[model samples]
Target: MRLRDLLIDIEPLRAGRDFRAAFIARTVSLFGLGIATVALAAQVYRLTGTTVHVAAVSMVMSVSVLVGSLVGGVLADRSDRRRVIIIARSAAALGFAALAVNAMLPEPRLWAVYLCVAWDGLASGVSVTTLMAVVPTLVRRDQLPAAGALMAITGELGSIFAPFLGGVLIAAWGAGFAFAATAVTTALTSLLLTRLRPLPPARSTDGGDGGDGEGDGHDESGSPMAALRFALRERVVGGLLLLGGVTAFFGVPVVLFPELVHTRFGGGDVMLGLLYTAPAVGSVLVSVGSGWIGRTAAPGKVLLAAVLVSGLAVAGFGLSPSVGPALAALVVVGAAGTVYGILEYALVHHSTPDRLRGRMAGVLTSQQTTGDIAGDAEVALIARWFNPGAAAVFNGLLTAVTAVVVAVAVPGLRRATLPAEDDADADDTGADGTGTGADGGPGTPSVPLGTGPAPVAAPPRAPAAG
Candidate 1:
């Protein structure tokens, strides 16, 4: 393996101008969102003087994200992705501006903060779903791993900076400035997107339909129920969704951080800051060194293993008596979590046909957001009932157990094999139900697993293993 391959892949950025634009847009927007994330919690806490109120903002955001992603998925499947993104970004920017305005008030209305957050969450869900759907369209199949890697790295880096930046802005200036900065970044994203190619839904190829992508048949593909039905029918998709849910709500420890810092660690604000930043640091290190993962053919196995590792890491963090060990445990958790995300994105993108992509993306986001809120709630509840350490250990062990059970039970996902593009031109209906053109009639074989591809000039290859 050359040293260059070990570094982050840049072909996704190089091969497609649209991908590059979207990449930059997401990175910039994430930074802004990061700022908003911190500011929102701080403002809410300031106003209410209670952790519960601060938590409410996150809960509202999660519910709104679920609603938005569900609706946005259907829209992404039926309409122009570019347009959906533009509208979503615009709405989100406006929401941020509202936050800014609310912050500037002498006595900011608490309700106004929640309102802006809900609105922002709705638009954010739309933007995230549409953007995921648009990736394969913008770049070749081979570039997906790189694209996903880039996205993860950008997000981690943005997250690392945004909190500190928000703290500085809020301390030096105020929450109003942080909110305004987010608004500006969002507006800039919309402006940058003006040059990207328009993405319309891929019709017949989306979910095994044989017709050219058009007309009323498109309506069903755009439905959330349709996506749900497909997922139930496909164990691979269902399994991945389950894994994500487990990781989100059960494995994530965001809600318990402050409590652990104050009680278990006996640390103050500085220690709390380190706890928050540790994951991003680990994620960045793994992302830049992600070349090895793409070479693995059995990404499903790898994905499950990543989950197991994450669970164990969290368990270790829970048991660690010292801050240093806890921080080390966090690094492992972060790396494992990042790999899981990359593989999940690659595997899902590769398996779904063009039409169903948007809906699946929507479902993915919805589950993830729900898990986040639920996980936080559970951890907090557990802390209240027991101790933070016990909660962490319990969740971590449960997450690991869940992964093992899912891995053993979900045969389709467990045994599924991604192709190496040897028969890219072979005509076969990929188990994904996507149709392909193959002149070699009976001799041609479909993709080994249930995953499929639709008709396209260049056959849709297996998704990247990033």
Candidate 2:
């Protein structure tokens, strides 16, 4: 393939100045989180060496994040997303500042750590949901996939590299410095995001469409229940979500890696770390060259194929005879998984109406996390009955097989098409400035943002791309 095909999609960055700001903010925020995660884990281990104690600290953040995600979704639908994000990120920065202060103490209080973690989780939850809700408004309809690709790439790089940098900092200075660094970055993210203009809630209001809801020809006004109802009601979206659920349940290789190192590889700690990090490497490479995938007609098919690739590669990694082959397989799994993720985000944003976006995004995040925890528990149970290797192979194979089944069953998803980009200006909500979206001829109707029930209309056929 030519290098151009593999080149990163820079259009979103070039086209949408606001998207560029959001992208930068995402990179900074994730990096800070990664650093804080490592610092927190190290601090916990220092205070109490037991694995259970470490897990306890983590659980506090997890519960808070879950709660925050739900609340953030509701808030995003009710008010201005840009303002919500600014406030949320500012709170996260305060969380890190608290961590820094606690770490600097001669003897850091364990309770303080838990408290700050909970605070951080709440702030992050709100930040994440509102940001996901805002991306479509930052870019054109056609750029949604590219936007997704950018986010996945940003997250993968941040998660992969930031921990290593944190480790270096911790070794040279201390956890206090790491926490301070994260605080500074979080502050920077908030400042940069502030440059964005105000974004009103996309929830439908009566007969008026959200003309200010960023030009996607959809309205954003509905209850959280409406978001859930839409997910179940839409065939393609439901299929994609089901796919996420299955993958999370069956994709338990990460949980098995430590055990596999001694049982199969005879490797040391460094090797184990390499095994863990391999997928991120693969994901980064594919993201760098993701332009070609965006040009394809059958995005859903491509996503299913990605799922299949991930399943097969992960299974192969589990069954490999030696370290080299297993590592290579893991690389493929990472690349494929990244593709699946980008497409899933693209489809979710493209298909869902504006009003329900935040809630839907929050729900999907919760489901994925739940699926992961459940899978880890289930795989551990299976390992108790069989060896870890056996459990890994079984789970991987199941993931691959199920992906095929789902793809064959959902033709609409395979044929899914994005709406053409339009010249809808964000400032023009309606002729009356009431936030009712402009009336495109025969376009699809969204939930009314007003007090009364809004009218629903059939959408026109999507026009060809420019």
Candidate 3:
């Protein structure tokens, strides 16, 4: 199919000035972050010459991101989302600047690197949560899946180019300049955000009967733990969080592939760059086709299939002897990863109300961070004992186990349908009871037993007019 036709069919974003501006800003920021990822890995390896140190950096960033996501979620629920994003982006810019200066110093301590990573992670978590929370407000509900696909495409595009560019920059102008470039891009992103009109903060409406409101209620006391508890109680939100954790656990080990190429395959920077590019190439293709995938299948099923496929592909990587085969395996892994990422975001967005979107985003981010930390530790330990290829096998096994558990335990999640745009307007009659829509038709089937109904079973309604 033609690209325009594909986009029209799948994309949820409206062609508006604000969306265009935000897209440009987000793209630039993602590209910069991608470059920084490669630069950071290279710098860490150069400093300590150990895979363990590289893993430690990832650990530090993950922990910081987890904490930041929690805090950011609480703030996003209360404050203006745009302002939160601006502040977070500004903080990231400053962190990049700090890293750039540290790179120039004569004897940069390892602790300095850790501190920079922490700062960057915190800013990144906050910014990401706020940005995600703002998405529903920008586009129509029917377009959310397409918008999600577009976001994935932008991220993959950034990943596809950044490693090669990072290597080139590092080789020509040192890691310092690479970080400086990140700072510049970050500043530009902040500027773009500044130009956008202010977005409304999430509103909390109290039900007349003193019952918990339609939206997730915010405890204005600024307690992160309370928000965490609320998120845990949300059946769909919690499920998505669990799914995200699984994805991170199974998928993030790919980050270790560069080190594998260096030590096991005796390839240097160029090979490392190619290894990073391999999955991204697959991701780009998958992202381009994600719109079709979303339309034809339930998101949960797509997510499960992606995870299972990724697991098998990763296992293939473990068995491959040559770099060519390994790269091909990575391509498979990347395609699955792309589909999984899109579904994860869509599920989270669908499950959350606008009021709690920020907190939900934060919760999701924290889960992802926790997963990354755990995955990194697991991979590092395995690599220290066995070969990197063996570590890949372990990661694949972990993914398979998680997928199986999710499929069995949360059968509702397997094909949980997206609510029609007006599902929220339908009368709430507790779970499992029939409710009528504004159009006097049966609405979403809410399963009280927790094993939700299929999406296709949703009541038929006239197609919404464009």
lDDT of the candidates, in the order given: 0.74, 0.73, 0.67
Can you give the TM-score per candidate against the true fold?
0.88, 0.88, 0.81
Worst 10 residues of 3 by lDDT: 457-466
Going through the candidates in the order shown, the clash numbers are 7, 21, 2
Query: Model 2 RMSD to the real structure?
Result: 6.6
Deviation from native of the Cα of residue 416 in model 2, angstroms: 1.4
User: What are the per-residue Cα lDDT tens digits for candidate 3 across 1-466?
Assistant: 5566444233343444555566778889988887788888988898899989987898888788778888887777678777888889999999988888888788766788899999988988888777777765565444455666677778778767876788899999989899999999999999998865676554443422111233355344254454345445545445555656666766746656776777666578777767778888888887776656556447677777788888888888877787888889889988887777666665555444455566666766776667766777788788789978888888887787777787777766776665444543243221122233211123423232145564421110001000
> Which of the two, 2 or 3, has more TM-score?
2
Can you tell me which runs of candidate 2 are displaced by over 4 Å? 205-223, 419-466
Q: What global local distance difference test value does model 2 have?
A: 0.73
Q: Write the residue-wise lDDT of candidate 2 on 366-436 in tens digits.
A: 66657767788898888889988788788888899988888677666666644434422332122122322
Off by over 4 Å in 3: 1-14, 41-56, 105-113, 207-221, 224-234, 255-270, 383-387, 419-451, 454-466
lDDT of 3: 0.67
